[model samples]
Structures are given as structure tokens and as C-alpha cells.
Target: MNHAQIRAFHAVASEGSFTKAADVLNVTQPTLSGQVAALEEIYGVKLFERRGRGIEITEIGRRLHAVTLRQFAVELEAEQVLLSARGLMSGQLRVAADAPYHVVPLLATFSRLYPGINFSMSFGNSQQVLQGLFERKSDVVVMPNIHEDRRLHAAPLKREPLIVFVDRNHPWAARRSISITELPHHRIILREKGSVTRKIFETALESAGVKLTDILEIGSREAVREAVASGLGIGVVFESEFGNDTRLHGLTVRDVQLEGLEYVACLKDQKNSPVIRAFFDQIQSSTATNLS
Candidate 1:
């Protein structure tokens, strides 16, 4: 196996750009591209399709990336093991989350406590973020823990209720709560499918026999908020994530309870890793200090 070629391919695959991959690997773009091209040439397979000013991984490339994810993860573990002897001082961890509100606080706490440690975060819907965890793209993830899975070491972080909101001048602005029955009257803006908040909201609507007539589906929280703020429609989100947006007014879905359990989780196999364990412990310690 050509380790250098595989590393080059993995960098490009993960970073999604030749420029980014080269910068991360500290190599010239030509050198990195040559390494990947050589790998394909020697293997007699097409790995990436050149798009205009970009590239797309082929089916075989994705399959190979899956294998490389595990291969490099073990390599990272080995490196972490060697570095642990230096008092767990220097390390990098990748973190993903379905939403930023819950995980961002934990990250802030972790950063304050472990100044030497470096971390990166990416956000997506619940499904996308969890996929990143399982695919080894992230060492840990923060997301809703609604499903049971033995493959993860999940620590419950918080339970926050979902709320609906609208532009400040909307008819419901003065109200503190809304019923599922009342939602269908105005256009309802929601996160795209796979969002925990949207899932809970939709499930409740289904149970309540509330079928929304006018719907505007958006792909992210900030976008949905902006859509609502622009008077396009009503938007639903976690109470904690509502923030202090003066352009909007938040109203609880008081008729039926809608909440999500935030959890900081790592693969069960990786819970014992030094940085992952430290993160888990830090959250527990932070929770304890808060309760005390």
C-alpha cells in the first residue's frame, strides 16, 4: 500500500478541495495532485471525476474513503497514544453537532480547561452529523439522543423545549405560546428533514391531526430564522437557540410538549481515547459544578 498516496487522497476527500487538501498536508498542489493521480494510475481505476473548477469522488472513491477513514483513525489513535505520555498536553479532536447551542457551550468549557488541545467543529442536521461520527470524520458529536444505540457512549447534556417564532410584527408576536391547530393558518417555515426539531415538531403535528397547508422548508436554523424574520412564515426552533434576536418573537408550543435530549457522544470503541475521555469527563464536571 502506498501510504503517501493514500494520505493525499484522504486529505482531498475530507477537505473537498485540492487547494484545501494541499494546505492541510503542507504540500504543493501539484505534488498532492500527482500523488492522488499516481494512486489512480497504479490501481487502474478512476477515483475522482473532474468537474468545472472542482472534482467529485466516484463510487469507488467513496468506498475507498470509507476504508481510509478507519485506517487513518487507527493511525490517529496510535499517534494519540504516543502523545499521551507528554501529559495529554497537545492534541486535536474533531467534533460535529446537529445544532450549535448545546455543543458550543461544551466546546467553550473544554477549551478553557485544556488550552493546549485544539478542536474543530462542523454542523449539520442530525443525520448528517451522526454520519460524520460513524464515518470517523469526527472524534465526537453532540446531537439529540432519541434513539438507542449500543455503538455509542452518549452522555445526556440538556433537554430543551422547541418553540415557534415569527417576525416581530406578525400577529402572534405578543403571544407566548401557540397550538398546533393554529400553525396551519400562516405559512410555516421548517428545517429540512433529518432535523431533530423539525422531526419532533412534525411528529407532534401528525399526532394532533394538524396538517400544514403552506410550508417553506429551509436547510438550516439561521436560514429558517431569517426567512421568518423577513415575514415569509413562522419558524420552529429550540428554546435555547432562539437567542436574543429582536427581529423575532418566540412562542412555546404549549399544547403539546416538544423537547430534545442533547448528548455528547463518542463511538464506544473510542471512549477510552485520552482526548475523548477528557471531553466526556469535562462535561460531567461542568454539569456537576452547575448543579452544585
Candidate 2:
């Protein structure tokens, strides 16, 4: 097996861009391309379909990428073992997260503890970040409400209730809380369908028998915040994430129990690796601090 070529292919497949893969591997783009091309030529099979200004991994390429993900994870474990033996920690640590609010502090702690480690984060909805974690594109993920799976290990970070928000000029701005039934009276701004917060909110609305007809589906929390601030609609967000904004007011939900329960999760097999363990330790300690 051509180890260098496989590494080149894995980099491109994971990043979905040759330029990024080259930068990641510290190789010239042409050199990276040459490695992939040589691999394809040797196998007499085209692994990628080149479209103008982009490329898609073919079915074969995806299968090979799956194998490489496992292969690289093992390589990561081996490397971690060596680094631990030398009493030094260095190398890239990739994190995927649904939001920046909770993960940022943990990252700050880890950065302080392991200044030699390189860090990268990719953000998405919970499902997307979880998928990235399973793909090995990221070593760990900050997720909300991930299901139990034997293949994974999760460290509880937080569980906070969702709150309603309105612009300062809205009629309910002075109110400290509102019942779920009140949601039907106002236009609401919601996250996309895939959002775990939206799912939990919807479930709460259903349980309360509140049917909100006037709803706007926005793609991100910031967009929902902007919409609410512009007086487009009232918005909902986890209490922990609803930072103090002068233009908006957060009201506790009176009856419904919609909350975001987040975790720092990684593959069960990789949990013992030094960098991942360091991360889980910091987050767990942070959680303990919050509880205390």
C-alpha cells in the first residue's frame, strides 16, 4: 500500500478541497495532486470526478475514505502514545461543534494546558457536527441531545432551559416570563428544522397544545437574534446561550420545559488519547465548577 498517497487522498476527501488539504499537509498543491493522481493511475480507477473548480469523491473514493478514517484514527492513537511517552503534547486536534457558546471556554482551558497542541473547529447544527465526529473528520464534538451509542463516549456539559426573547420595544419586553400558550399570540422566529433547539421547542409547544401559525424559519442563532432585534418576531434560545443584549430581553418560559442538554462527545475508542482526555477533563471540571 502507498501510505503517502493514501494520506494525501484522505486529506483531500476530508477537507473537500485540494488547496485546504495541501495547506494542512504542508505540501504544494501540485505535489498533493500528484500523489492522488499517482494512486489512481496505479489502481487504474478514477477516485474523483473533476467538475469545473470542484471535485466529488466517487463511490470508490468514499469507500476508501472510510477505510482511511479508521486507519488514521489508529495512527492518531499511536502518535498520542508516542507523544505521551516523550512527555510532550503536539499535533492537530479537530473539534466540531453545534455552537460557540459552550465550547469556547473549554477550548480556552485546553489551550492553556496544552499550548503545543494545534486546534481547529468546524461549526454546524448538532446532527451535522455529530456526523462529522462519526466520520473522524473531527476528533470530538460539542453536541445537544445526541443519542446513546456504544461507539461513543459523552461527557455532560450542561442542561439549560430555553427562553423566549423579544426586542426592547416589544410589548412583552418588560415581562420576566410567559406561559407556552402565549407563543401563539406573537410571530415567532425559529431555527432551521434540523436544529435540536427547534425540535425541543416544537415538542414543548405540542405538549402545551399551542399552535404557532406565524413562524419564520431562520438558519442560525445569530440570524434569529437579528430577526428578533429587528422586531421581525419573538425568538427562543437556551438560557445559557441568550447572552445579555441591550436590544433584546429574555423571558423565562413559564410552563413548557424546553432545554438544551449538551455534551462533549468522542468515539469511545479514542477517549483515552491524551488530547481528547485533556479536553474531556477540562470540560468535566468546568461542569463541576458550574454545579458547585
Candidate 3:
């Protein structure tokens, strides 16, 4: 019924624990519990069910939480609008990056321009990054390759080529360029499932009728690079990601002959946010300059 109760309910629903929600809201546990209880009484429905040590949101709670999330977003946007009218742009920016290398430069530039704005970044595979955007956990996402999603509006930030890398000791290291079919027999080290790189690689391989052998899945880009450097397998990564690596020499960046991929995306509804718009503009201009 009140902003305080709504906020407490949302926090508890998100964190799944009254104690953790209290910590996040900087309120005592008892205060948070009382507010939630009051809201439950007003609604005449149990919002959450007690689990072992935490709480699970009830079906009604999920619906209410979704509505509350939108309401909170609208409220925050209203505040941001007021702040912008007063020539102030000070707020938290939550971003999820599928590929950290692609986001670093853009974030650095944004930080330099808006020194007062706080940034919270999370790194994950492309699928997870997109999920974060859908869940409203991240305001925007930077992805190496974006798939078709009705809920997202993707902007073409940059189109960069994918390159193949191998250790210096590998036999293929001496080749200038290897055919896609040649890769099926080699040990291929790829990023974990849900990564754009993995998806792109798989699609290309499938198209070429090249089935890779002995695939080793790694979680992070750095881990993939290390695995390739140790002569475990060859890896396919963005060309920009291979800068200044002395140990692992570029065998030959085989031009997969695929179209360059997009690197940025935003939730369709969140595109109206002023902060997100500004950041998108910055990224567009920066990408244009870099590509030219």
C-alpha cells in the first residue's frame, strides 16, 4: 500500500531472505519483517512461503513483484528526468557484458565523461547477459553476438571478425590459413555453452559440415587463452581480445568469412531511459570513430 512496504516486499522477493533484504535496505531485520507482514495482511494473501532457511515467493508474489518492478522502474525514471532537467546525471548504471574486452573501452569512456555516475558491471556468457537484461537486473548489455529476441533492441556497435588462435608449438601454427574442414580433427577449446563465440562457432561448423573433435569447454576467455597456450586446443575468439599476449602466438587468424557481429543491446522498453540513451549514443559514436 505504501512505498516503504512495496520496497520491502520487492527486496525480500529479490533476495529470498529477510535478513539479506534488511542488509540491502539498511534496515533492521525486524522492521523489514514487520513491513512485509503488514503488506501481506493488506493483500490478504501469503506472499512468500518459508523454506529451510530462506523464503520462496508464492505465485501471487511473483505477479505482484513483476508489477512492483515496473512501478519502481517508472519511479526511478521520473527521478532521473527531474535530475536531468536540473542538469544533473548522477545515478547508478547497471550493465552486463558478455565479453569484457568489448565493454572495457566503452565503459572507460563513459566513466571519463560522467565521473559522478556509479557503475555496477557483471560478466557472463551471452545467454546469461540477455537473461539479466530480461530480468531487469542490468539496464543494458554488451554482447559480442546477439540473437533474435523480441524483448531486446540491438544496436550495431561494431562488426569485428572472429579469429582462430593456436599455441606456437602446434603444427597448425605454421599455416597461413586453414580451411574450416581442417579444424574438425584438432582439439578445439571453446567457451562454455551459451557464449556467443560458442554459438557462432557451432553454427559455422555445422554449415561447413565440419564436426570438431575433442571439444574442451572453458568458462572464461582468459581460461580459453591459457588452455590454448598450453597446447591443449585451438580457440576461436575476437581479434581484439588477443592483444599483447606474448606466450600464445596467433597461428593464423582464419577469416571465417562470416559477417561482422553486433556488440551491444538494450531491453526494448528500457531504451527510453535517458541514461541508457546517453550511453548508447556514446557507444555508437565511439564505435564509429574506432571502425573508421
Candidate 4:
């Protein structure tokens, strides 16, 4: 009946447990349970089936939860509108990035300009980044090599050449560059599937007819870097991203024409959101000023 009771029920239904739902709502477990109980009693409908420690939402609960999702989303949008009208003095901006390399610097610049705005970041592969945007889990996404998607608007920020890297102890460490055909001779460590960098590099290799014999697939960029630095294998990454790690040496693939174009993107509907707009504006200003 009331927003408090609705919020309690929604949280409980979404989280599937009164304890966890109470934690999410920042209220005591008993208080949260009381609120939900009152709502169900008033409506004369059982929203959830209580097991010993677990809870299951009934069909009616699921329907009500779906409606509450839209209702709360609109409520949040209203709050953001008010915050935007107040010159963006305070608001939360959630961003998802494929890697910190492209997003951290940009967020740092935005924070410097609007210190009051709270920013949070999540990292995943490019596919996950896009999925976050679609699921409304993130306000924006930073990635590279993203193709055109009508549901989103992507702005290219920078292009970085794909390059090879190896540990100092590796025989190829002393070399400034290597040929694409020579890849099979060295152990190749690649990022897992859905990684844009891995896709680009692999596409280039396939086009060049270079089939790597020894391949290791790692899930994270940090892992790939550590593996290569430990002389486990040769790693490929964007030149701009592979910072000056003294333990590893970067080498250009002489005949490969692969590059990653970093981009900042958001759902097309939210492209004009105050937080998203501000971030894009900062990118433009920074690009014009060559701040990086």
C-alpha cells in the first residue's frame, strides 16, 4: 500500500531472501519482514512461499515485482532529472569497462571537474560491458573494437595499435618487432573469448594464415600480462594499454594491421542523460586539449 511496504516486498522478491533483502534495504531483518507481511496481509494474497531459510516468489509476487521495477526506474529517473537541473552538483554514475586502461583516465578527468559526483566502475570483457548497458546495470561502457549497434551510441576516443609483448628472458625480448608468421614458434597467450583485443588479433592471424601451435587462453588482461612477464608465453595487447612494465618488452608485429579503437558508449535512450552527457563532453574537451 505504501512505498515502504512496496519497497520491502520488491527487495525481498528480487533478492529472494528476507535477510539479504533487509541488507539491501539497509533495514533490520525483522522490520523488513514486518513490512512485507503487512503488505501481503492487507492485499490478502500470499506473495512468497516461505521455506525454512529460503523464500520463493509466487506468480503474483513476480508480476508485482515487474511493475515495481518500472516504477522505481521512473522514480530514479525523476531524481536524476532534478539533480541534473541543479547543475549536476551530486549524482551517482555507474560505468562498466572492458579494462581500466581506457576508462580510469577518463573518469579521473571527469572527477576532477565534478568532484561531488560519485562514480563507480565495473570491469568485464567487451561483451559483458555491452550487456551491462543493456541490462541497465551500468550507465555507460568503455571498450574498443565495438561494432555498430543500433541500441547504443558509441563514441570512438582513441586508436591503439595491437602489439606483442614478452618477458625479458624470452629470446624475442630483445627484438623491436616480429613477423606475423613467426607467431607459431613462440607460445601465444591470448585473452578469453568475447575480448575485443583477442578477437582483433586472432582475426589478423587468421587472415595472415598464421596458425599458432601453442596457445594459452587467460581470462583477464592482468593474468595475460603476468603470464607473459613470467615467460609463460608471448602476449598481445594494445600499445597504449601495455604501459611501461619493465619486466616485459613490447614488440610490433611488422606485417599486421590490427588496432583497437577505444570507445565510450551508452544506451541510445540514455545518451542524453546528464551524467552520460557530461562524460562525453569531457572526452571531447580532453581530446581537443590533448590532456592525455
TM-scores of all predicted structures: 0.70, 0.73, 0.72, 0.71
lDDT of 4 by residue, 39-129 (tens): 9999999999998878889999989988987777677578668877788888779999988987898889899988989999999999988
2 or 4, which is superior by lDDT?
2
Model 4 misses residue 30 by how many Å? 24
Q: What's the ranking of the predictions by TM-score, best on top?
A: 2, 3, 4, 1
Best by lDDT: 2
- What do the candidate models score in CA lDDT, each in turn? 0.85, 0.86, 0.79, 0.85
Q: Clashing residue pairs, candidate 2?
A: none
Total clashes in model 3, counting residue pairs 3 or more apart in sequence or in different chains: 0
Error of 1 at 251 (Å): 0.6
Write model 2 residue lDDT over 170-266, tens digit each, in one string: 9998899988887888899999888888998999988888899899999999999999999999998988788888999999987867786788899
lDDT of 3 at 168: 82
**Alpha-carbon lDDT of model 4:** 0.85
Error of 3 at 213 (Å): 2.7
Query: Lowest summed-lDDT stretch of 10 residues in model 4?
Result: 283-292
Question: What RMSD does each model have against the real structure?
Answer: 6.5, 5.5, 4.8, 6.0
Candidate 1 residues 149-169, lDDT tens each?
Answer: 866788877777888899999
